[model samples]
Structure formats: C-alpha cells, structure tokens
Target: MSLSGTRTHLVQTARLNTFVREAGDPSAPVLVLVHGNVSSSVFFDALIEELSDTYRMIAPDYRGYGGSERKTIDATRGMADFSDDVVALLDALEITEPVDLLGWSAGGNIVLQVAIDHPGRVRKLILEAGGSPYGFGGTHGQDGTPTAADFAGTGGGTANPDFCARLAAGDRGEEATSPLTTLRAVYVKQGFTFDPEVEQRYLDGMLATSVGDDIYPGDSVPSDNWPGSGPGTTGTNNGLSPKYLNQRAFADLDPAPPVLWIRGEDDVIVSDTSLFDLAQLGKLGAIPDYPGEDVAPTQPMVSQLRAVLEAAGEVTEIVYADCGHSPHLEHPERFVADVRAFVQ
Candidate 1:
C-alpha cells in the first residue's frame, strides 16, 4: 500500500470525543489498533499504512492522549475506562460486527479485556508487548501473586520525576532519560535508528500524555518494601497495578477468539526480567534499601502470559529477535506479515 492519505477525525462517543485515524477502505474487515500508555494512535500509523490494503485500519487515542478529550482515567476500573471507551467508539462508528483487535503495551491489556468481556465483538486478538496478565508491577511468581495486598512496589511513584518533567517540557535532548533517548534506546531494537522526520511526531504523541495522580503515573501509597512506595487508587499506571488488574480470568472466556502474541525478543519493558520494573531494578541495587528477591521477586511477565494463553489453548506467539518493545517499528515488515497471516 502507498504511504499516503491517512485521515484523522474526532468521533463523539458516549463518554467523550475520541480522536481516531483511519486508512484503507472503510468497508474492509476492520483491524482496530490501540496504543500504550504515554502514546497515542499516531504510533501505529506506520503499521496502519502498511496493512491498510489488507484491512480497514482504525486507531483511536484514548482519553487524555493525543487530540482526544482529556479526562481523568479511573484506575479503580482496571482499564475498563479504556475498554469501554473503545467499545463506545465502535458503537458510534456503527461497527457491529466483530473486528480484529491489535494493541501494544498497555493497549494490549485493554484489547484482552475487550475480548474477555465482549467475545462477540472481537474476531481475533493480538497483543504486542502487552503488560502482564497480573498487571504492570508488584507481583511475584509465575502465577503473578501480589507481594503485598496494596501492591506496594508499583504505581505512579515508580515513574522517574526527571523523565516525566522532560516529557512535560517536550525535551528533545538525547540524554539518557529524555523521551527521544528512551524511544531510541528502549522502544526499538538496540541498533535501530528512527527516521528523523517521523521522530518528532512520535515525540509529540508522547508529550500529549496527561500527567497526575488520576492520569499517567496515577497515585501511590507508602510501602515497607524496597523503594518504599506502593500503588494508590488512581491513574493509568495504577490501573495496571496488581492491586486492580488481572487477565488470568481470560482463560475463562467461552468460545475465545484466537490470539496472536507478538513481541520483540529484546523487549525490556515487558520481559520476564524487565528493566523498567521496580523489583528488577531493586534487585540490581539501583534502588536503595533493596529488598532481596524473597520479598518482591521479579515478575515473569512473559511466562505469566504464556501460562494464561496455554490454558486458553488458542494463542500463537511470535518473538522477533533483535527487536525491542515496539516490534511494529523495530520489525515492521515481519510484524505486518505476522498480523496479516494470523488474522487470515
């Protein structure tokens, strides 16, 4: 497909106005793409362009992201705010038939929730470096047991203030923690270089992230655990805390849709030993007063998902070697080919 003619629109859903991008024929079988935390639909534009000829690609920005109406994301709902909003977008667009769903990072979790909650509306499911079924943090063991009832090692407090500040300021520096650096170093394959022309648009999408206790990082509680912080009641990050989110129940879905779990083999954000995880960093002595593994062992996020999907018995996983968190960007051709074949 030619890399041109992408259209953007704002649709009035029941909850709020959602900003969406569309490519390809409207009547083609839809492939709904959802992006992760701190990003918007724009991140999937490339993937959409590549697959547009085969599918009607629709990517929507969640509330408080991109050009969507900014609103408080209720963490207590466990991504229900995002899932419901997606459902509303589909309804508003009059998409009654089940659609193929693809999501990356936190968005992956949202699509899973949709499949679990509304099986009739999802034809196939794809999770691209999705968060753990146990949620983002504060868990141990393959079963994803919470280290503390409060999920004391996870939540908004886990975010680096300097990094958040830089994002808010739209800092384009190549420093270790700058948004651009993070994108280059962590979001893609180690040696991959992003196109300079498209980098600023991605940065703009990242900076559009809403910050606060009720938003991106959410709130936190004091913890006896290492680093001394736990998940609090609200925010997009907190919503993924083990305190409120779990996708193990996904195995219970009847007549479950086939799932494709595609990820970069080098992903640090959602790996068995994630560099972004507090427990992993704590064990590495990066955080002071580090508690040994007994108290808060690193959560095997990939192992957890595999177990859940194995139990469900309809998952196909693809690991792209030499790739990072965003396989679509790191290995777009393979990613698109995998998605196309899997959906077919």
Candidate 2:
C-alpha cells in the first residue's frame, strides 16, 4: 500500500467538483485531511509525504478554496454544506466504511459537524486548532453565550480588508497582511520555515481563495455590541459565528468516535485571546471603546471543546510546545508520528 508518488484529480461529487491530492494504495485504510480557512489541502503536503506509507491519504480542496470549483457557500447552514460535501466526496469515491478524519482550524469545525451529523461515516476525529464549539466569536463564557443577539464582534467584516485585497490581487510581497507573510507569521511558529518551493505552492493555494461576501471572511451586520459589528446572514466566518455554529451536540452521538484534540501552545489564531477575535482586540485597546471582561471576555475556545469532548468520552488532548496554528507545518515529524499512532 505504500507509495511515494502523489496524484491529483477532480472528484465529481454531487455538490461540487472537488480537487483532490491522493497517494498510496487504494486498498488501504482511508485518511482524509480537511484544511482551514484561507488555506487549501496544499498545507498537508509534507504530512502526506510522511504518512503516505501507513495509510491511503486524500486531501480535497473545499469548494471555495483551492482547485475546487468556485461554488457559493451558504453561511446560514452553519457548516452543513462543508460537512455534506465531504460525505459526498466519500460517496463518490465509493468509500463505504468509516474513515479517519483530520481537520485543521476551520476544517476542524467541518469535521465536528460531520461527526455530529453523520456519525456513522467517521471512525475517529482529529481536531487541530479547530474553531470553538461555540463558533468563532461574539461569545462570553464556556457556555458560549452570545455577546449580542446578532453575534457582534464576529463575522466577515472583521477580516483585514488590505489582506483580502492583496490576496485577490495575488500580491506576493512580504509586507504586512501579504499572503506569504501571513503564511509564515500567523500560520506557523514565527521562526519556523517551510521549503521555499513548497511555500510558493501553498501560497498559490491560499491566493486561490475566492474573495467575496459569500466566502472566505463572509458578510457582516452592524450591531449595538461594543465593536458595533455582528454576524451577517451569509458567508464562511459568519457561518461560524455563535449565531450559526455550535457542535455541542457532538456529545450526543450514539457511538461517539475517539477524538484527538491537538493544538499548538503558541497558536495566536485560536487561543483564549485570539488576535482574530474582536472581543480580545477590544480588551487590549486594539479596537476603540475598551469593553470590560463582563461585556466580552476572551472566548474560552479550548475549554469549550474540552467540555464537549470530555462529556462524549475518549478524548485525548495534546498541546505542542512552541508550535503555532499549524503543528503539521511547524513540527511535521511529531505531527505525523502522533496522527499515525492515533489512526493505527
């Protein structure tokens, strides 16, 4: 089943034409990798190379991101579309049995949705720096109480406009918010670096992201909340807002799968005081009108996930020291070893 070659193909699923990178023997156990926001399956290339021998590897670009078709993402579904798309991919591939699923960041949200909605299809779940069970923002406590009914402090408007513009323009410069700079600084541990050629490939996948109100950062709504912004009725990040997203139902799965929650100790993107979250920014005076913790405290993302998973049973937590948002990229060998052991 071991193989060194990588192959790319367009899987014609009922939902959208998915672009997949696969390797290893077809007869082997399946390992599907789902990537995060502003990123494609390209980030998993190194991990695939390291684990290809042990299991069949399949990494598919989600509909709006990479080589996949630029289909519209309906934010109201609360990641149901992404979850359904993955199941459709498995169906198209004729993968009847349960498969090991691994998701990173936003993809972590997708995998949890799949496990909750289609429990039979997932044998095990790996959440790497996944979004909070309460969703991305506008929450107060571990219970994920909305800071505002509109879920203000979250959604599409929060995305850095200059960054989105640069991505749309395919700017390769190293200035702040540039795709390359983000890939290095925010995505991984600050000093960790990827091979120059591979970095270029991943950057191409990142820039391939469809920039609009219906995708990537998504849309927004004005709110009475401190930040004065809230989740819109449409878009990806909005879909993830507490108003639309919550996977606490995962604890109710009849035959809950074993879960591996792996995260980087230094991951600023998904931390308790996430830089991307407006609530944290507001507390730090990064945003105007400093709100006290009672109004908008740092969303306890890890605590929320733990509370749900621990209730479900058989959850293992691993925090990688010195790692950032992407453990697979910042520490590939360790990530590969841990995942291989988990799946095996």
Candidate 3:
C-alpha cells in the first residue's frame, strides 16, 4: 500500500507521536492536509503526489486515528486538542511561517479551529466536504440553532453500533454496514470505484480507527430529547458535537486568511439532508419519534458553512458534479489544479 514518492514517518510532537505522510521538497511552501473521521492522512496520497512538485505536503494522523499516538480527546475543548496537536507538529518541524491548510470532512472543522485560534499560523484555508462551523448535526438553519437543549441527535450515540463493530473487527466484506461498503456508498458517490490496491490502502486507514467510548464515537448520555441520547464529555464524536464545537468566531478574526471551499455536488455526509443526521433520518422515517421539524429540523450544514465563511472574509467555492465526499480522490487533477491556483 506504499505510495510512490511519499515518505511516511512519526514525529514526536509535544502532544503525541504523530504519524505523518510527506511529499515534495521540504523547503517548498508547506501545505498541511488534515483528514476527516474514520480515515487517515493516507486519504490524501493522490492529491499530495499531484501537487508535490510545488508544495511541501504534510499530512498527519489525528491522535486516535491512523498511526498517531492513542489519546483521549477532551470533548469539552471542542477541536482545540486536535488543532493544538497540529500546532505542536509545526513547532516540532520548525515551520514558523504560516502554512496553507486543507481539511476534509471532520478535519475541515479542526483546521477552521486552528485558523480561528491561531490565525497567524495559517496562510490560507481550504475545506473539502468540511463540517459546519457549528459542528455536525443536532442543529438547524443557517445560524445553527440547537434542536434540543442537550444536543441529542449528535455525537457518539449518533454512530451506528453495527458499523463500529464491523470497523473494529476489520471487516473488509462488502456488507451494508462494513467499512468497505461505507467507503463506496458514502465516501464516494454511487457507481464510483477505486483501484483495488488504492481501495485497500484507504480501507486500511479506515480500519485503523481506534474504537472506544474515549475515542471514536466517544461517549453518550441519555437525553430527554428525541433519539434519547446526547453527547458525553469525551471522545472524538463528542468533540464534534455542537455542544463542544463551534467555529463561528472565525468571522470575528481581525485578519482571516483567504479560503477555498471545495466539495462534491453529491456529498451526503455533510449535506443539508445528510443520511447520518438523526433529524434528517427521522424526517425520512428511518428513525421513529422524529418530534417534527420544529422540534428537530434537518441541519442546514452547507448554508451554515457558507454564511460563516462569507462573514469571515474572502472565499472561493467550487462544486464538482457527479462527485461525493472524497473529491481529492474522485477528481485529483481538478482538485489539485484548483488548490494550486488558489495557494499560489
């Protein structure tokens, strides 16, 4: 599963031992790539290769995912724990100059946190199928108002137990809840396929996810609201909960960096009608006791993102037709070209 021209290694940042995948010249302007949930930096291999000639690419595994040190994510800090780890990695590498950042899915939220907290450290920002500034699920409207006081339909409890079980067991079979099936059905658009070897590599990354109450999906608490569960104060999923995570302050930054927002037109994971959103599922009758739209309306994820980024400053958006969550993999050439044109 080794990618040509890519170098993989571990860096002992102050926070943890971060496994990093690097490509291109070390002296070139750095372009840090952050991956989303259930996957690792390995997801960016193709894009790194395509843009290596002009950018020093550094993709690191988050603490509980891929080859990074396994550690408990303090959900109370939102994504600060993850963003601080990225900052520590840059410090360890002596990359004092601001670097370009590109985050995919959940990673997009982490990068936005970095830009919000450490604005001077980022030269530019790119979000690919990124999460909303208010975090994922349990919210509605462009302003991201909470559907329930407990933020019930979001976080660890929102994860499918069967999918987590299959992932923990490294089930490569194409069963409906298996990682492979999710890869094809959710990670990319329907009918899209990856090269067998590349697919295996990506699956390997997915399988590396550390499953536990203090890690993937984190922990949950019983809620009085619909779906009956709320985010617990630990784990990655809770960290992503609107209760713990919110990047709306990004708009308040004195000098926000320019942004390039890219996403697949067919992305479902972070869409307004995301299948994973409990409210959306309830509305569709997939989950019972939906509590109606007023009590628990579908989250306007894309609209929330657009509103925040627009308020922040400069933003350039690109939507690719016939694509899904992983635009870099589905349209590497265009993705790289779009990024190059922006970062340059």
Candidate 4:
C-alpha cells in the first residue's frame, strides 16, 4: 500500500492483470511470500517491511482476495492455477532460477505444491504451519482432522488484532473496511470470535483505502466448484473437489522437494492437532519411522523434520519455541534471520 515501493503488474490465469510488490535490489536473491485464503498480500506487510532491506521480495494477492479483481463465473482457477500464477509472476519478472519460497498456512501448501510440481525452481522450501493434502510428517491429517472447527470461533473469530494495531498506528494502508464490521460479519457469516475494536480499526483503515461500494467481490471469483462434502464443498464435485476430495489441484508427491517445516508452538490452528501425538511428536498412523517398517518418525518436531531431510539427504527444519502458526508474523526477527541463514 505504500507508494514508496516499486509496483509491477503481471498477467496470470485468464490474462488477469495482477498487482505485485518488489522491494530491495534485483541483483539480490529473490524471496517470494504467498499468503493464505480469505486474506490478502497485506498479511505479509510486516514481514515484507522487515525483509525489504536485505533480500528482494515479491508478494502478490491472489485473485478474489485483495486488490486483484475476482474471477468471472465463466472462468475458474484452482490450487494448480494459483501455483501457476506464482510461476507466471516469476517468469514475468525473469526469475529463471529457484528463489527462497515462503508460504504461510494455506499459502505454504501452495508453495509446497509449486516445489513438488516443478522441482529445480525452488532453492529452499519454508512452510509456516503449512497444510498439505499428502500430509507432511503425517502430523496433520488427510482431512485436516475435525478439531480444526474448534478454532473456527477462536482467535477473535478471524478478528485481526494486528490489523487493528496497524490502524491505530495511523496506517491508512490497504485495510479491511472496519474492524467492527468485519467482526460482526465474522460472527454472523463465519461465527468467529473477535473483538469490536478490531472491526473498528478495520473500518477506520478501510475508509483510508479507496474501495468500491462493495468491499468483498465473492461474485467475481473464477471458481465456485464444490466438493459436496466437508468445509465449503457443494457435493457435486463441479468437475473439481475441495482439498478433502481433490488431487488434480495438488498432485501426489514423490519424495517431494526437500522441505523445511517452520511452525509456532503457540498457534492453535496449526500447532494443536487432534491427529498429532505431541508425546510421540508424530501422527498415530501416517509418518515413517523405521527402515522398511513405515514406523512413525520418533524425532522431535524439528528433529523429525531434520531427520526426514537427512533421510532424503537434503532438507532443513527450524522450530521457534515462542512462535505460533506463523513465525514470520509472530517472530519476524528470528524468522527472517533463520530464513536468511538458510537461503544465503
């Protein structure tokens, strides 16, 4: 939102012109940050601001989320399509080689898919509480486990307190309409648990950003295909399915690209999983343990990740004690420091 940064346009998925941010020097190594669903590139504002001085960074809002226009009903774009958007954006920027990739939560899943689908394009993989259909370390489940719904109403029910703080800080950047309005919408529409102040700040900051009469452009999304079961499916499969039922979007990975698991112990959504046995530090039935035994990896969360990489002969994992689902957001200094150490 700050006009001081360089802005560039890239065409992706249906020739839709997408906006992206470029910070630091082109000569420096590149870093791409992908955000999660129902959120925009703005989510990475703090991280970007911190990293801009050292590494060249790019963060683009997926269609239907931020400044980008929604996809028309006649068109559609899925996870693969979104990953392709990343590739297209990179190609447009002439990033012919792999760059450090950081995907937070759902964005982490997207980044993993990108690395899996197109190896050699990624130098290092960093997944922040990233969920995968194939389940990494089997710590998460195939269906994300039912416990996730419990968090639905937690954390202010999607009430972004950070966005509120930014607003109070006099940041007129691209903010949601209002913290209160968003909080009300969350309770009414999504059943979230958020504070009114968040909504108030959202409204205040939103007024600062120029928005149309309609703030959300759901009607403009390219794809509305439903899975007919679980989460937001339509049960019809719509020639496509949700993560719970679809693989066309994320392919079955084979010894997938070396992975780095970065998670926060405090994140309820990403850290607290019913499937995980914190005592065992692995899933009950999904992870590999002994050679040819398919035993669960007995390593600690980070150590297990490291063991997985060591077994693969090339991967890295770093865990922050005080971090949550998004260490980059929760512990920016340490997160960026660790990432720079690995990437450089």
Candidate 5:
C-alpha cells in the first residue's frame, strides 16, 4: 500500500521549518502526537503505522528537540512556543476542525496548552504519563517548578551546550544528531518494546549526517540522530527559550477537551511532588501571586496540578500497572487500543 502517510518539509519563511507526517484517509479524524523533553516526532513510529489505517497523524519535531531548526537565542524554546508550532502546522495543513491531540510526557502539556488556548482545535486528549505543569504555580507558590522528578532517566540526545544552543534556536532542518537510540531501547523495553525496523529509523533519523550513522538523522532535535555524526560545534547564543519551560503560559488555559491519563504504577518519572513546587512557581515574576504560602522551599506542586485537572470533569484516569513514566511505549498494544477506544 502506498506508504500509509507522506512526509513533508515546511519552512514558513524564516519563522519555522517543520517536518510533518500524514497517514490514513484525508477525511478521517486527525491525530497529532507531541514528544516530551529530549524527544522528537520519531517516538510515535508504531502508533503512526497502527493508526495510519484510520486516522491522519501529525507529529512535529519541536524546536531543539527534533528535525527542526536550532534556536540560537534560546528564545524559540518553551511549551507555549511549541504549541504555536503545532497551531501553525495545523493551519498550514488546512485542518481547521477539532483533532485528537495525544501528548506523551512533556508533549502532553504542549497539546494541553493548545487545547486550553484554542479549544476549537481539539476533540479528545490523551496524555501518556502526562507530566505536571510546574511553571505556572498552579496552586502552590512563587516559582514555576514541579517537584516531581520521576521522568525516565533518558539523556537528552546530546547535552553538549553547543548542540543545545543550536537546537534551541530552531534549526533542525539540514543538520541534527539522530534520535538517542540507546535511551529509546531502555524506555521501549521497559514499557512497550516494538519491532526493530521502526527503532532503527528512529535512531538513524536523529543524527547530524557527518557521523555517517545508520539512521537518517532527520532535521529535528539537537544534532546526532544518525550513527557516526559525532558531536559538532553547535554554539549556544541564547538563554533557555521561555517556551521550553514557560509555566505561566497555561495559567489562563483550562482545556475542556476529553483527557485520558495513562500511567504505569512504578513510573519513577512521575514523582509525587510536594506542594512547595507550585507555591514557588506562583510567586515567580511570571505567575500570579497567591495567599498564605507556608510550605518549605522543598514541597512539590504536582498534586495541585492533578487537583486542577480533576476539577475538570472531562479527565479520565488510568494507571499503567507496574510501568514507569512511559506506559504507552511500555504497553503499545494497550496504549493503541485505549487510544482507539478514546477516539472512537
């Protein structure tokens, strides 16, 4: 069959250059997947294939995270900034109707912000290990920091400052390291391990090409998705982009989309943050101020975030049994089946 989906490269002038994948029928529902921190569009390879027969899927390599441009000034990064990319990508595709938004880990919050900011864009939402929003100070304190630290121990494809600087600047198009396969394998096997070919392409596509790696080293994320592309001189010119970690961006948002929360019981990444994390975020220069904050500087605010979502009747909670932060990758069959049911 004509490969279920087609890949297209888009450059909106000097503003953005994004790679988009579309599968299944044009008339079918649209499914958009966003990867968490240190991850790119490659993680959804299996979901794309399984759902390709039904839904049209769109996965974008967030700036500094995938085959997109690197941002030098660090101004291009942030969850809100990434949300903007998602919105732009959809507009470019001429898809104006509500679409199914699925965000794994950090990506979940990205899509959530979009749904909250533009409710018309989403119908159903699936957050696989949807992380807590620690930046906006949801109901906690002065700083926007979540206390939960159970995120999978996967290293960012490359932590080299130079690489981070370039990747953060939004220039993943022609040069970038392949996806971190070593990390992917551990996470995959820990949760939903899959067929090898998908993993190979995923690993290959994340490189910077000069490495002569086996992967394609797609133009997203920090350099090094493919093999042989050793770390290069990416050069960091900016501070962390506000979008990559902006918590206040979601303060005004209360996305009413149907939310499915799937998590594995043993997920170390999903740590139970104390209330202090939220309180700190609220007092930060960005978040609005709250009253009577007495918790020590060490309290985590993840619980408060949970409270916020719980108040939203549209949320559905599912425990991933003994899995870690990535239940979907941990249990792909279950993940796909649940997703299919939710969208249906």
Candidate 6:
C-alpha cells in the first residue's frame, strides 16, 4: 500500500520482478534504503515520508521478500545475488549516477558487497544495526573466526522451527513465538512499542517473507560440530552464513566510499552477546552441550564492523542510547538529522 507522498509498484529487472516503494521528487538526489531479513521495503515507509522533501527515496523489496518474485537464494554467492539485484534495479531505473545507500541488518551486508564490487555506484554508505562483515552467526572474535570447519550452528538449521512455522501460517496472534511477539520482543529494545497502525504495517511486512527449504530459513547439512548442523547452499539464512557471506574484502578498497554506521547501544540482535547466536546461548546455558568459551564464544559484531570501517577509510559511527536493533524506528527525528548531516 502507498503511504503519503509515496508510491508502490513493480519494476522488472534483468534478474527478477522487484517491488519498489518510492517517494520525493524524481530529480532529487537518490537515497536507496535496503531492509533487513524477514522484512520488506515497507519498513522504510516512515523514513521515506520523513525525508521525502530532500531525497528521492527508493526502497525495493529484494527477492523472497515482500511483493518481489520468489526465488531461491544461492548461498554460495554470498551477498552477490542480492547486491547484483540492487544494481540491476538501479540500472532498470536508468539511474547511472552514484547514489547514497542505506542498508539495515542483512541489507547492510548487501550494500557492503555492492560497494566492494562496484565502488563507483555508491556515493556514500550507511549501515543501521548491520550484520557483521563475516556474516551473522557461527563465528567468533572481531576477526570472525569460524566456530567449526563446516561453519556449524550458523545456517538455515539454526532458525527456530516454531517461528518459521508461525511465519508460514501467518500467525498474527500475540503468542510467545508469534511474529508479532518476536517483533515486539526482539526487533526493538525492551518496553518499546510501535504505534498501533505502524505496528500492523510492520507486522504485515514481516509476514511477507517467503518460506521454504530454499527460502526463509533455507536448508542445512549434518555436521559433527557442537550444533550438529552446517549451512546449506540455498535460502536466506544459509545465504547469510559466515560460510558463504564474507565481505572482508570491503576493507581492501583503494578509496572506499564514506560510511555512516548507526546502531543502538542496547541492540540485542547484533550485539556482541547476541541472544540469537547459538554459541552465546550455549554460554548462557540456554542451549545444551556447552563447548566452553575457547571453542565457542559470542561474535564481536560491533568491533568487527568497526575494524573493517576503520581500515576502509572515512567513517562516522553513531550509537544511540536506550535503543535496540532499529535506531530509525526508535528515534526517527535523530536518525533523520544524522542522515541529513552525513549525506548533505
């Protein structure tokens, strides 16, 4: 659905049909927003509306999410598939000039891949509670060392089955494991609540996730590691595995684009002790078969990101207190001010 000053439509790129939400004047400087996993471009609706006067905002729902064509994500390619899709969309729109890019969560990794592969395409880069350069889970340290040779405990298999089931069933109830509850508990910090209408919109976006073996959680392989499973070669979760998605090369760029890294101080999802990390869970006794800290430790996501950005060159880091994984949602006024300062 279109929001005030915004329009939703489908754009057929060379790779697939993509759903796009756009706002602001066509002649304005372009600012592309890429949403994270389990969510579509709809998450950016408020931001688009907030900044419509200054930017030609473009938010596209990548494959396997929102109204985009459902396609199996090739985990072996890392984030190349998604990054290429973004570039293809830009090409389809005849946007030849470099544009400002903002990526949230998984979308952050995709944008980094884009900058690494096609540096000239991005005028500046913004990562909001982005994933580690080394991928999401099954890794440790600021360097992102794999926990196992097979990269166990970090793939489609790691996904909570009940959560996926609920997602597939489109369960909109307030059950503990339901999408709404997860969004409420995990998406943001504790005690934070969305406006009722906005909450429903975001919930609808979350439910749009395509579910299948080659989709949402993807597939996995047997392993002798502590988790007893490894990343499979298909689906979104596997595609995000450290085994496949590693953008360490981003630091090697001769002259990387300026970057603005914004994250919440209390972000549980991407924090060093991320609750989602099986290793962290194991340490906290939430998962059985503790492998000890030496064998498995919480991934130092923020430090790793800082290291890469520092090495890459010009970088600005902003941490918001009393916030969670989504600074944009929690502090829209501040978020917009930061963006305006950085991009202007």
Best-to-worst order by lDDT is 3, 6, 2, 1, 5, 4
- In candidate 3, the residue pairs with backbone N, CA or C atoms under 3 Å apart (3 or more residues apart, or in different chains) clash, namely none
Give the TM-scores of the predictions, in the order they appear. Answer: 0.97, 0.97, 0.99, 0.59, 0.65, 0.99
Tens-digit lDDT track of model 4 for 59-147: 88664445665443111222455576788788777789888888876677567557756766887777776643322222233333322
Write down the RMSD of candidate 5 (Cα, Å).
10.5
Per-residue lDDT, model 1, residue 188, is: 80
Model 6, stretches more than 4 Å misplaced?
A: none
Worst 10 residues of 6 by lDDT: 138-147
Alpha carbon deviation, residue 209, candidate 3 (Å)? 0.4
lDDT winner, 3 or 4: 3
Global local distance difference test of model 3 = 0.93
lDDT of 5 by residue, 287-322 (tens): 343332442142333453466566665777887675
Q: Write the per-residue lDDT of candidate 2 for residues 1-344, one digit (tens) a residue.
A: 11248788899999999999898789999999999999998888778877778789999998888899888788888988899999999999999999999999999999999999989899999999988888987776777777777777888878988999999899999998899999999898899878888889889989999998878788887888778878786778888888889888998887789999899999989988788888788888888896788877888887788888998889999999999999888877888889988998
| Candidate 2 Cα lDDT to native | 0.87
In terms of lDDT, the best-performing candidate is 3
Expressed as tens digits, the lDDT of each residue in 233-303 for candidate 6 is 99888888999988889999988999999999999888888888888899999889988988877788888
Error in Å for residue 180 of model 2: 1.4
Candidate 1 lDDT over 230-313, as tens digits, reads 888888888898888888888988877899999888899999999988889988888877778888788899998889888887
Lowest summed lDDT across 10 adjacent residues in model 1 is found at 1-10
- The TM-score that candidate 5 achieves is 0.65
The residue pairs that clash in candidate 1, if any, are: 152-230
Error of 2 at 226 (Å): 2.0
